[model samples]
Target: MSTDAAELTARLIRCPSVTPEEGGALILLSDVLTAGGFECHRVDRNGVPNLFARWGAKGAARTFGFNGHTDVVPPGDLGSWTHPPFSGFVADGMIWGRGATDMKSGVAAFTAAVLDFVAATPPDGAIILTITGDEEGPGRDGTRAILDWMDQNGERMDVCIVGEPTNPEVFGEMIKIGRRGSMSLNFVAHGVQGHVAYPHRARNPLHALVRLLDQLTGAPLDQGSEHFDPSGLQITTIDCGNPASNVIPETARAVVNIRFNDLHSPDSLFHDIRAKADLVQAETGVSIEITSNISGESFLTAPGPFVDMVAEVVAEQTNRRPVLSTSGGTSDARFIKNHCPVVEFGLVGRFMHQVDERVPVEEIHALKRVYGGMLEKFFS
Candidate 1:
């Protein structure tokens, strides 16, 4: 049986499963895996589809899993691409589409590798795949849900490898080992409305809000951690409208997002921020309220046999030492981290979510070889 990597990636790219929509993308994969001597199961949760498949020894000792998502972020500014964003056209030796580099390509490469691995000899250990459709949007819809499902169904994994475009300068440059936590907060300061000319008659919320923001931004959340960098807090937005220069605004609002390391927790940051706001209010009459959105917590799996296996495979196949970096933003790996030791690596990511995003045909073939090597070594 032949495993055509390009054709599989093109089929997946054709479906514009942007965010919460599957666009029949998972079905395409289910068909392919089902025909490849693997048992496939589909679970639809909260209007999103998550697919799981397995092969080789039943109840094997080590259940190695390949985890990925089929969804793509919206192709921003549609007018910028050379071809339709969902067309998945092949031109200039690239399979052009939105999810080509961010993901999808990595999935196809590994699937092809698995097919090749099984053909040579039945998989040495149990191989499982968890493909979710809600990764690009509110993560609550996919990996998090599917992981719970896996646990309930008695599915366990010894190790998990996420295909999240870990390469930066070139293929095989980086393999992410951990990720920092992400949290967002919005605070609005309240004050009495009055004419600016009568300073004693009204409280200015802007004055207190500015002070609160100053305290939050003045210092680093922390010095660099042993294995991670210092935490960063950025003020994303601040709005205070007092259309009239002669009037004091009733409210002033600011939004801040913090990318924190293991040194800090959401609870600690919330208290620290509130303390700063309180101090500002003690000096000014403005009172404030805060709301938060938490995406994930920082997590790292100490370098061990599982991570070493992937690094060694890349070294042998690419003939270059791969850097195990925890550098980019977070991914579904955040959800997977709760259940199993997870890491991400894939194609060059210079084009993810960009107009005319694509991966070279040669690069696709090379990636397939690297994946094949990894699977072979893991099962050997």
Candidate 2:
């Protein structure tokens, strides 16, 4: 029996596979793929569930892969949803449930397309699927773990398509060619604690921290790059949790998040932030410490055969030329970029992560047709 994308999507949404929870979604997919003659593996790590499946011989000369997550973000304020978040209800010609658009539907579309494609054409190369349950959580052990295992086991894909919900408005309207990098910086300023009444004796750390933040946000990181907007720095938090107005606090902390393009690196940005801290220390005589965490660096898969082919298929299916874009927060695509050239395409995503999240029923089948077309063209 051939799989229908919409029905598979409904089954997936009913799992309530919230981040870091297997919720039985991967098991269902594994069963489906196994019956279709694919070698499937449960790549579980750190209590998180992931699936890697392949059809065709190992190390085939040409391989195509799809990467996605079955996990959905938590459904907040359950009473606020029109339909139960996990009901998988079909109403008004839409599939209403969590993960409906953010991407359980995307996974279903590609899986259905692959099942039909291999049975019909039996491509000359290989088809691989990597689905994870930890994408909406810490994400350290999802796709990254699968890639590590693939390296050890000698599995590789020449090109990959991340089934992230890429279209902002309508289906087939956009494809992500690259993504900006992300980093978080934390600052702590030390001061001498004393009574507020003694102005000359007490040093205020808040004053120094404010000066440091001003310097960091004083100007734009850079002018817009060829394929990206200018890097952005936003102060996310400032803490000086002293309740007593009479006493000055000994430490003040602040945090800033930076979204950057190819023009900068984590080290380069860290160096600049430390320089500002040093200047503040010299002027205020207040000791300051800076620390940072780099999530993922910016990456781009330049328009080429793989990208052109995906775009061509999208345009033909929807009758609208898709725009190559790089606007969005980071995704698993960041990790996949290290393995091979990668791009992101899927259904319209206006409802992702929102209460009553949904995808139009027609769009689900339309997406399957587009994915099926790409598979046919890639193998021919």
Candidate 3:
């Protein structure tokens, strides 16, 4: 790995910025960006610190943005890690840490590559880097605030590349042109408490919830779109919350999530899914209530010249033809797509968000080269 990449990755890993907390991660990035001649903005929105940095001459109509987050999911059961989760240990030609590949590494790569690129030659066009700290949590802040700030600042981008780790098996093997929108729902069916055998005396919410699941998951949401696949709805959980063996619980609940393609909107999809639950209400005495835990709505960027430029530079640097795809979970890219055409391409993500997260040191250098080349080619 390049020393700059290794040093910066180690710095980020040491910050301990587990979702919603800065933990020094944002400071590390801000310092790097400031040194690179970019004007940096530190905005605290909804309690999360988001950074937006830009560098280039005025009137450069062509602006490129690199977006990603500094936060990572919690390192569950710390005992499961081979090395300390925040140690940033290096062995076997890889770096091991929480968010090492999921992707503090990608953040480091883009930042360092931009620093180097700008130092050698002042950017021919504007380059903006948007970093957020609310990706793995409630996500009520972060990117949404950054985009709003950009709009108020009169910043428009030609294209934005989100450095989420997109590769599965080989570096540069996949580029996510879009993401499946995700929505999570918790449904509760209310009924009267009763004996197991008393059917008419008390409504059985459990039965209503079970039948509702049947109708909801019975078929595919749609046949898939040109840049996306058929919408999908998966039941993540179900609970009667009844510990008693002989008594029918007064309430039953189920939590479900859907990764939808462009075929549906979160509002429409939620309305449709809720209608199925309401059908049970029409026939039964039970009451139904549904609530949402939103991740993001699905979004896509139609492949065009800017996307082509990223693909060509990636193949040229890594010699791996990137697969143009939108087949992944939701990301901050989902939010950025509304402002500009955004695509995601980065290091191999085999071990991201997993115990003992690690990235091959070789891949780090390759990603840096790819990012540097993309910046040079796009603005030249």
| Candidate achieving the largest lDDT | 2
Off by over 4 Å in 1: none
- Please give the clash total of every predicted structure, in order: 0, 0, 3
RMSDs, each prediction? Answer: 1.5, 1.0, 1.9
lDDT of each: 0.85, 0.93, 0.85
Top candidate (TM-score): 2
TM-score of 1: 0.96
- Candidate 1, overall lDDT? 0.85
Q: What does the lDDT come to for candidate 3?
A: 0.85
By TM-score, is 2 or 3 better? 2
- How would you encode candidate 2's per-residue C-alpha lDDT over 1-380 as one tens digit per residue? 56799999999999989988889899999999999989999999999899999999999999999999999999999999999999999999999999999899999999999999999889999999999998898889999999998998999999899889999988889999999999999999999888989857978899899999998899999997898989999999999899998998889999999999999999999988898889899988788998898888999999999999999999999998999999889899999999999999999889999999999989999999999988988999
Candidate 3 lDDT, 1-380, residue by residue in tens = 22388678878988899987898999989987887788888877979988988888534778888998888889998999998889898999989999899788988999988888888877668888998998887766888888898788787777888889998788878999888888888999998888888767878898888888889888888899888878778888888867798798899999988888877888888898778878888888788899987787777677788889989999899787888999878888878888889989888889998999998877887888899999998878
The lowest-lDDT stretch of 10 consecutive residues in candidate 3 is: 1-10
